[model samples]
Target: MKVTIDQDKCCAAGTCVLVAPDVFDQRDDDGIVILLNERPPAELHAAVREAADVCPGAAISVSEDA
Candidate 1:
């Protein structure tokens, strides 16, 4: 699974980071969404999906590569 976050769409609410700290974070100054891991381990796929689901701004995207 691959994860991507659109900073332009992010509200900086930190929901994604709160859901999956290993995959998402906030920039220090702007508090924008930051991609901590563009490609996370399979073990973390579920958590990454959860973060994408709960993102209020719809900033997170998850794709599965077969």
Candidate 2:
């Protein structure tokens, strides 16, 4: 799985980070979605997808490279 975040579209809602702290994080100052791991383990796929789904700004993208 590949996770990417569009910072410009992100509104700092922190949904991505909230759903998957292991893969996503927020910038301390602006609270933007930061990619902690571009290609996280398969175990984190579900949470990563959930993060993308719940993102208020729709700034998260998840792709399955399997």
In TM-score terms, which candidate is top? 2
Task: Pull out the clashing pairs in model 2.
Answer: none
- Residue-level lDDT of model 2, residues 1-66, one tens digit each, is 888889999999887887899998989999988899999998898999999999999999888876
Listed per candidate, the RMSD to the true structure in angstroms reads: 0.9, 0.8
**Per the 3 Å backbone cut-off, how many clashing residue pairs does candidate 2 have?**
0
**TM-score against native, each model:** 0.92, 0.94
Q: Positional deviation of 5 in candidate 1, in angstroms?
A: 1.3
lDDT of 1 by residue, 1-66 (tens): 877778899999998888889888899998999998999998888889989988889999888974
Which residue segments of model 1 deviate by more than 4 Å?
none
What C-alpha lDDT do the candidate models reach, one value each? 0.88, 0.90
